[model samples]
Target chain A: MKLKEIAHSRTGDKGNISNISLIVYDQKNYDLILEKVTPERVKAWFSESVFGEVIRYELPNLGALNFVMYDALSGGVTRSLSVDKHGKSFSSALLEMEI
Target chain B: MKKIRIGAGAGYGGDRIEPAIELMEKGDLNYIIFECLAERTIAIAQEEKLKDPTKGYNGLLEYRMRKVLPLCKEKGIKVVTNMGAANPESAVRVILNLAEELNIKGLKVAAVLGDDISQSIENYMHLEVLELKNPLESIREKIVSANVYLGIEGIVEALENGADIVVTGRCADPALVLAPLVHEFGWSESQLDLRGCGILAGHLLECAGQITGGYFADPGYKEVPDLWKLGFPIAEVSETGDILIEKVDGSGGLITTATCTEQLLYEIHDPSTYITPDGIADYTAITMEQVAKDKVCIKGGKGRVRPETLKVSIGYKDSFIGEGEMSYGGSNALAKAQLAAEIIRNRLPIIGCEVDELRIEYVGFNSLYGTKIGEVLNREHTLGEVRLRVSGRTKTRAMAQMIANEVEALYTNGPSGGGGAMQSVKEVVAIGSIFIPRSDIHVNITYKEV
Candidate 1:
């Protein structure tokens, strides 16, 4: 099953970096997510768009994991020629990751 | 048992007005906060100011004041906002005049200035821009606006001086909500924990409807009811900095632990250390629980001492973008779209443009993913139609417009079934960040009463 089935995500941007938060609907699924969703896996999953390092932070209380991807916005909303200037669709793109 | 009710109104400059009106009418709000300015907005507003001094503030400030001031007077609700994008003093005057026209008595309006550091920006040319490798000197000629992200100082001062409406430029989004908490409960600079909690509350409330299910709706996955009539969020805060985020009773949108958790992580990096001018917030300890229907209580946020320096956003003229789109349908639609893209690619150079970068995409297929989405996308059946989009970035506006003109010419010159052509050309305003000393920046507040 896809991560979207058990978890949801939202993408935000600042400068050239993009931050995506993945949260599980159930607290029981947090461990499964934590075990499978490693920073290396995420970096490889988004290898096409993400260039710089990917840092992952754990929010145990909220059953969520936040991933900060650097050099992700193609120089950000101002100069990015991408149709999705703010990378809004990246959240949906992240949901496509299989667990 | 001291508590206050604050409504989140107008998350951005172009936000919906009806939800804010709903809050004003029925949310029973003691205060309403609107966080409207973006990083690139003030730079564009600064350019507009050069064209007309009276027009630098948010374009909808007049319309918002006209709609909310009369209700504010009747309901005795205070207003705080960063709608004064490039000019706060002028925004103050606009509100004062709006009060007179509406005949709303005893309304005091205040404006916070000094966020604009452009005149003295030369002194900081040696500082390193956080985003770019270049120093300030490289973009000095292209600089249009430079403004600091102020904390609660200016807004708190306005509230302390008995101003019913507070207007400011370039204040941090969380500061718009945190300032009122400081003024009402007498939160001191040393009360870092409470300040942290308040800033966290501000962050959750800053985006308005996002906390109340505007962005959380997914058809079969996560369901949010009555999303079309989405309601903005309201925060009920105790003196100890505990908060309950909810919306008006019977109003649309859902408020649950899930929604609250999503919003808590939205637009934030380093959840443990969120640095602001007022305090450095630690969100790791935060806990959310559903206390009642459409309400979630938040608690246990940590905080540290405030930063010694403030962040400044620098806006500069970047470049120009030109784009055009045309669609082709019927048999061999994919082939036609590919041929159209090839034709445009060959013709863009012939048209003569100093192109820095360019993209040719088929709208239904590769525009978003930018490449093949595995064999599934390739294993298509009965392809109907595809739109070809060509976009380019150029240093000159004329050169950029030439790309759009060339694509437009494809209708009569190149393709057979190309239809519904659309094009656009605009100047790009980019943003840069730098840290400046707190002591070097000054804030000035002016108040006027009706």
Candidate 2:
């Protein structure tokens, strides 16, 4: 199943950085997601868009994980020529990740 | 102390006003806060301020204030907002006159000033930019506005002085909601733990309808009921920082644990060290439970002392962005779009129009993710229509307009069945973050009564 089936996400941006918070619907899937969804995996998943390092923060208490990507947003909102400058749709794109 | 009901009037500058009206009328709220400034909006507002000294606040300030002031007067609810954008004093004057026009008596409005550091930005030029790690002098000439992200000090002072409405330029978005909590509950500046919870409530409620399921509906998967009539959120916060998140009864959307969890992480970077003027809030320290229908209880968030330096957003003229789009439908739509993109790519340099950065993609196919990622995701489906989008950033507005003109020319010059051509040129107001000593920023509250 895709990550969207078991989990959901929200994308937030600041400067050239973008952060996505991935929350699982069930706590039972937390361990699996935590093990599979690494910083490296997420950075690679957003291959063309994310050029910077990806950092992950764990929130097992709430059955969620946060992935922060530096040098994202192409050149941040004002500078990025992207149609989705803030990378708001990056949340839905991350949901395409297979689990 | 009694539990205070605070409702988020708006999330951003151009958000829906009807929901805010509903929140004010239906929700028995003590306070309604409208957080209007975004990262780049203050700079845009600054640009307007340069033209007209009396302007530069939120464009919808008059409309929003006119609609809500009557309700606030009727219900005896106080108002707080950052709608003052680049000029809060002028905004306060506007509000004061508005109150007089509406015949609302004895309305005390306060303007919280001192965030605009553009005049004295040179004094801090020796400081290094936080994100770029470069000296502040790097882009010194391009600096248009520099406003610090203030905390609750100004608003607290305004409330303490019995101001019914508090207007500010740029403070932390959460401060609009947090200041009232502090003033009503009498949380001292030293109470980091209690203030942390208050800030937490501010964070959750800052985005208005978002917590009440504005952005969480996925349909057939994560469904939100009556999303079109989505109700704004109301935070019932106790003195100890215990919060019950709910909406007015019969309002649309919901407040489940799922919705709350999503908002908890929205726009947040480090869950453990989310910085604010008050303290470093540990967002992960809290747990959310669905205590009732359309209600969630948030408890237990920890915090440490705030950083001595405050965060300042420096807005500068970045560049001009030009985007042009043309849709191709009927047979061979994808092929025609590909051809159109190729022609524009080959035609640009030949036309002697250069840009700093360029991206040409097929909408409905690969505009979001690149062609490679789109292929991996949408390989099974054959596209019936493709919208060719050509976007570029350039130093000059004319060059940006030419970039858009090139796409519009494709109607007769390149591909057939090209329709609905849209072109837009935008002057980018880029923002950068820097820090200044808390002492350097002197927040003041100026009051005006009607």
Candidate 3:
């Protein structure tokens, strides 16, 4: 099953950085989930041209996944308030990843 | 000159409205601030959004907003809040609908966006700025959400743009009120002393009614009175950063030095290292006085330099978990449950599955209070229950299924087994933090005329 098809996810704002959590439907597919889902894969899925860092968290009890992407906010954190940077919100196509 | 009295509410999660409104009604307050996010609350918010996208914003409880917004609009008080969890624009849409329903005019609602980072996590990890003790490991696949608790500068920009009701995503709670105070007082961002003062003021009043009497009630705790109508806290911050922690007159609870000290000590590990997105506040220099029945005047808080690294919260995919429970009768019930958990642990691996954390709790035998009691006769052993819990990072639904299946097998193969068997196990996910350098992290504030 696709990641988006099976997991429940949500995103938050902090300039270019965003947090995403996903819950798998079946426990048996966890290893398959991890094997297919990697930081490099996620980075490629989300950004057209990679810039900054991606951090992840593993919560066993909640059956969920969390990701922190930094410098995604254009101009990095310092220019988070400038108007030119606000237009760079995360693309919805990247949000439709299947892993 | 008229005093621009701004009021900010405090509390963990979404419990800041009633008291904020009460203070607005009685104290002639000009601005109201509400703090409603924490670590656990964020988890809960994510869970709610999973059920329904619109339900994610926990602070938009109508009961809380209904009591306060109308009055603030009538009194010409501008309201600002970070109650906008996953969806600030949707929250703003709701507030504007409320304004229309109330027949209130010229209520401009603006949503401060661009903080959603769920899509760009991978790119962030590659920057080499995030310092993690462990290299991106197995958990990197489990990340569900990431949001940096932002500073108050964004709120200042929104206010400058003439937005009366400024709604934001995840701003540092204390900055909600401090931003307005900084703007109204014309305090410069470079004034470390003034900024530190604002941080101190925000800290004191952040946990609405907490400094007064929400969590730590004195010896007369029972007589605190009308807790249902407990007022949220309001910070009367000055240009110098001194704040008066008070509530609406005749509101429930008392504000005293003892209460203020108790609140200050809440969740505080080190008094000298109270940090916020705005700056680091020094609680060591704080002094509190019971200025009135419901007023505690706080002053003399100093500050130091902020850290060059920004704290980052990251999560990744782990394992799945499933749990169940069973009850037993008779005196030897407690011992049987203990043996059962051990048997399952030893037996599960044999069947090709590994368990990470396995625990069996004796519900009726002092499990919660941290007291241990031995299995004995003669003493009345009221109904007892055992909760078998297990966790693993492996892909083993059968492990959980087998544990449950074996629990039923204990009815015949195990000793003194009379009760029914239940199965419970959960998947494991890892959560850790990485620090991003100041030079690597970027933030910008701009103005958009409405």
Candidate 4:
């Protein structure tokens, strides 16, 4: 199953760092997410797009995981030549991650 | 417990004024705040201010004031905003003039200044906080504007002095909401938890309708009603720092646990330490309860001491961006768009244009998803119509313009049935951050009455 099936995500960018929150639709899926959605797995999933390290911060109470991707955006919006300047659609890309 | 109701009127500059007008008329708000400045926008506003001293505030400042100030004055709802982007003085003056034009009496406005550090940025030793890894001194020649992120103290001071409206330049976004809580409740710096609650409330409402389902609507699953009529958020903050987030009756949008959760984590890197100029708020244990439809109760915000250094947004001229797009339809549209992209990529270097970076995308198929999903999707599906988009960055506008010109030439030179051609060349004002000792920036507030 794809992560999007059980989760909804949103992406926010500050400077070159891209933070994507993978929030579960149901709290019951939290354990599943914890086991499969490791930072190493996410880093590997986005290896082609993200150049830097990936750090995941957990919020079990909220049933969410925040993935802060360093150097993910070609550059920050102001300097990047990419069309999706703010990386608004990056969350959709993260949701493509299969579990 | 004594409570104050504050409404987030505008999220960003150029945000719709109708929702704000709706808030002032019906929200029963004691204060309405407009977080109009973004990180890099003030730098661009500074450019305008330098050209004409009286013209640096948000472009729609007067229009917004004209529409809402009359109702706000009648309702006794105080207004607070960072619409004073580069020139608080000028923005304050504009409001005063508008009040007079509307025949509103005793309209008091406070302008908070001293955030602009362009004059003294060169004096400090600072490293670039974002991209373009260079010392502040090295980028001195290209620096356009530098402003520090001030806190709630100045806003508190203005309210203490009986300001009807407070205008600021680059104060932290949350400060716009937190200041009122501090002023109304008399919360001290030692009351970290109370302040943190207020900060969290401000963050939730700072983006106006964001927490109220504007950004949460997903057609079938997370359905939000009457989204076009979506109401901006209002926070009822109790003295103890508890808040009930809601929207006015008849206003569109839903306030739910899911919407609040999405916004709570929006742009936040760490839940435990969400830093603001006021204090470091810990949102890790925060809880949300759906009190009713379109209403949510928020609590559990803890705070720590403020950062010793202040973050400064520095803007400098980076490069010019040239973009061009042409749409294609009929048989093999996607294939035609791909060819058009290749033509622009190959043509740029041939014309002696030294592009620092370049991107060619087929918009209909995979402009946003990149190669990961795009490659797999392209193999299975075919696009009926596609737009070829070519964007590049270069030092000179002339060179950047060449990239767009080459794309437009493809319409007449090759790719059959190309239509809706568009091209643009824009100068990029790149923004980076640097931290300066808090003592280095001095904040002051002055009042003007009409």
Candidate 5:
């Protein structure tokens, strides 16, 4: 129901890479969500839209999932012109997941 | 024979330059360049312009300018800067007036305009040629500040037009040095490698003699001799696109391989794809050697083709944020602060109030730099403070104001007893960029007599 709960539920301390907590809301099946929301499972869930490495972890304390996406941003945060730092249109892809 | 020295100071926020001024007086530097504009600064400038059009220009920080300009004028050193944000013409007008008041003669002022592209944003979006994926849909209604970052060509044009002081808005940091190179050498824009070299030169000097020492010097902050009188920065650009990063005589800060390498790596995310308005420069391609004491020679900087389109900054109204602070006096202050934040979050939503962002920071308990987290357990409370910050769009006024009121009331329930409350939440405006085709945006370089 809350963002912090979502973040806390999906946190993991992996080697060389730490899982950053993120919250994706589910308006319909908020209660039906399962416990085992691994990064690999989350990546497979959004496999169609995601281009980079999507690693997910479920935080038992907060009941949330955290994901660390690698190179998800086109050109790594900068476009052809280096002055701007806005990444490409990937938010819709990010917002479509069922959490 | 005395060397013609130049010092460039990176400008950001109004700070005193007594040390730099003192150096200029003693060193006899010929030119000084000051740079100050980050992406965040651009956002803030746009927000201000939306609130009041006349107040957005950064050059209006005349307090800092007043202190340095008169000193430079007296010492006969030329200065170039991009402090003119939003309205450069108005900024120049003020500076010229200041020149007159100072009784400084021959103050050649030049203005670089035509970068503002707010009107043509719609036309560019409709074309659909360059895909702007997740554009800020909400900002379309009230876009405030929009300025394209120009290149060194404008700076060169200003210098060729006989203007001594070139004031610009949102120009690339390296353009400060490249402009002088273009003016002196007449290098064409198509010379990508040469332009890249010039940009590299600008990047080196843009920090205002920073390469020589300011921030890259030894630990314990050993005082450079007569640093109180340190110069800005000046580049001796050669016809071959070679630049000598040097400072005025008798100035402090060492220019060595270590210092130069440190400065080159500053704020750089990717070494290979270092982008500038001019072109993409390869930092690895650069070769440096300490040829002399306090002198670093940089060469072999490679550049690639520049992108066709220009990026424009767009800002829109977002939300109102309210913050309140109270000093936690009793023991276990950190626990009290955390509990207070938890209480606010849990109770705010019950009263028809939603928060977008809630941050509870213990200033003394945590380190501000990098991502290091400090332990917040079992610490004696000598002097501690807890600040609560919350942001939200829906809770614009009444709801956001109530959050502030609640924070103050926490003194009875909060751990620190009754300390005080401060209002911190205000409107949150979001800023993004919309690239327009080269044809839509026009860059006009004009020369006017002063």
Candidate 6:
């Protein structure tokens, strides 16, 4: 199943760093998400677009995983020339990742 | 068991005001706090203050205060907002004047100042932009506003002094919520568990309707009802720091575990160590329970020691962005839009325009995901109509205008059947973050009666 199949996500940005959180609908899917959605995998998924590091933090009680993508917003919202400057759609883009 | 109900009025500087009014009227809230003034807003507000000192507060201050102040004053509901933007003193004066106009007597308004640290930043030996690692001296000439994020102390002081309305500048969002809890519950700064719980409650209510399913809806999958009349969030916080989340009765939207969980993790990078001015709150062990419809009970928050350094948001003149867009419809629309984007891409170099960055996107196809959607676009798809958007940023307004002009020329030059051509050129005030010692900043709270 894809990440979006059992989880929902939201995106927020600070400077060039974009933090995307993925919260699973059911607690049972936590292990699957933990195994499939690693920082290394997220970095690979974003590849060249992310200039800095990708860090993932887990909130086991809430069944959520937050991925902080550094240097991801091109150069942050006010400076970025991209249409979606805040990287708001990055969560949807990450949902496209197959499991 | 002393408990107070608080409502999150406005989330951003330009957020809808009607929902906040609804919250004030129906939520039975003791405090209605507006979390406006983001990093960039204060910078722009500072520019306004430089020209006319009294004009630095939020643009909607008068409209909102006039509508809600009398009602709030009558109901004994304390109003707290960071709408002061670059000037809390000016905001205080505006609220006081409004109170006089409404004939509302004995209104206590408090203005919390000292967040602005423009002079202090210059004294640092070699300041580096947090996360970005950029040198501070590079953009020093263009710095418009530099304000430190004040914590709950100033707000708590204001509330303790019996201020009916509190206005502040550049305060941490959660601090607005936590201050009331601290003032009401008499929670000391060392009560980590209690403070942590307060922080959690505040974070949930900080974004107004976001917790009540405004931004949580995903249509067929995660359905939310009556979003058009979605109600902002209200938190009934107990003296012990326990919280029950709900919305105004009969208002639109629903709150469940899904909505609560999504809000808990919003904008948070590290759940274990979420830093704020008051202390470091850990939501790692956080848990929530749905007790009833449109109500969630939140518990199990932990707090660590507060950081010695405070985060400062520095706003500087970035550049000017010029954008142009035109729509194409009927058969082969996507192709024509692509051709239109190509024309803008090629035109810039020929026109000798110096752009720091450039972006060309086919609106319906690849405007958001950029090249990442290449794999999906490779699959079978059909686009009946699409829009071509071209934008570029440059230091000079003339250069920015040239980029937009090139796209306006597309109506007659090429890409036949292009219509609704639009062009815009605007100045960009970018934000950078740095950490300064907490000792370097001092806050003072003053109150006025009307």
Q: Which candidate is the best by lDDT?
A: 2
At residue B97, give the lDDT of candidate 1: 87
lDDT tens per residue, model 3, B18-73: 56766777768777776776543454455567688876675554556667668867
lDDT of 1 by residue, B1-450 (tens): 789899998878889888898999999999999888877889999999889998799999998889999889999999999998998888888998888988888988899988999999998999998788889898998999999999999999989989999999998899998999999999898898999999999999999999999788888998888887899999998889999999988788999998888888887889999988999999999999999999999998778999999999999988899998888898677788788778878887886777999978777766655563422344566567888888899999998898888788879986688898899999999999989999998899988999
- When summed lDDT is taken over every stretch of 10 residues in candidate 2 chain A, the lowest stretch is A75-84
Q: Per-prediction TM-score, chain A only? A: 0.96, 0.97, 0.68, 0.95, 0.42, 0.96
Which interface RMSD values do the candidates have, in the order shown?
1.3, 1.2, 21.0, 1.3, 17.3, 1.6
**Ignoring the other chain, what TM-score does chain B have in each prediction?**
0.97, 0.98, 0.78, 0.98, 0.82, 0.97
Q: Which candidate is the best by TM-score?
A: 2
lDDT of 6 by residue, B202-247 (tens): 8888888888988778876799999989888899999877889998
Worst 10 residues of 3 chain A by lDDT: A78-87
Candidate 4, residue B328: how far the Cα is off, in Å: 2.4
Q: At residue A63, what lDDT does model 5 achieve?
A: 26
Residue-by-residue lDDT tens digits, candidate 4, B1-450: 899999999988989888999999989999999999987899899999889988889999999999988987899999999999999999999998888888999878999998999888767646665466767776778889999999998999999999999999999999999999999999999999998998999899998988888767766667899889999999999998888999999988889878888888888888899999899999988888888988899989999999999998989998899999999997689888888887777777788989988888888677876766776557666678888888998999999889888888987985899998899999999898888888888888889998
> Runs in model 6 with CA error above 4 Å?
none
Candidate 5 per-residue lDDT over residues B1-450, each given as its tens digit: 222355665545343465456555654566667677755466577566668766566744576567666776677776777777766666677777777777766767787876777665665443322223455453466555566778766777778877877878787788777777667667676787877887787777765655666553323322354455445555666677666766666666666564565456444434455687778876656676567777677787767887677766655455565656665545566577667778777777787777655544454553121012123221334535544333333437676677777777787876555465666545544445666655565566544433
Residue-wise C-alpha lDDT for candidate 1, range A1-99, written one tens digit per residue: 788999998888888888889999999999999999998988887776788899999998899999999988778878888777777777776787778
Regions of model 4 farther than 4 Å from truth: B125-128, B377-379
TM values, all candidates: 0.97, 0.98, 0.67, 0.97, 0.71, 0.97
Models ranked on lDDT: 2, 1, 4, 6, 3, 5
DockQ of each: 0.71, 0.77, 0.01, 0.70, 0.03, 0.71
Which of the CAPRI classes, incorrect, acceptable, medium or high, describes model 3?
Answer: incorrect
User: How accurate locally is residue B128 in candidate 4, as Cα lDDT from 0 to 100?
Assistant: 60
lDDT of 3 by residue, A4-99 (tens): 455434433343455444445455655665667676776755553236677665544334445556655433222222222222223222234555
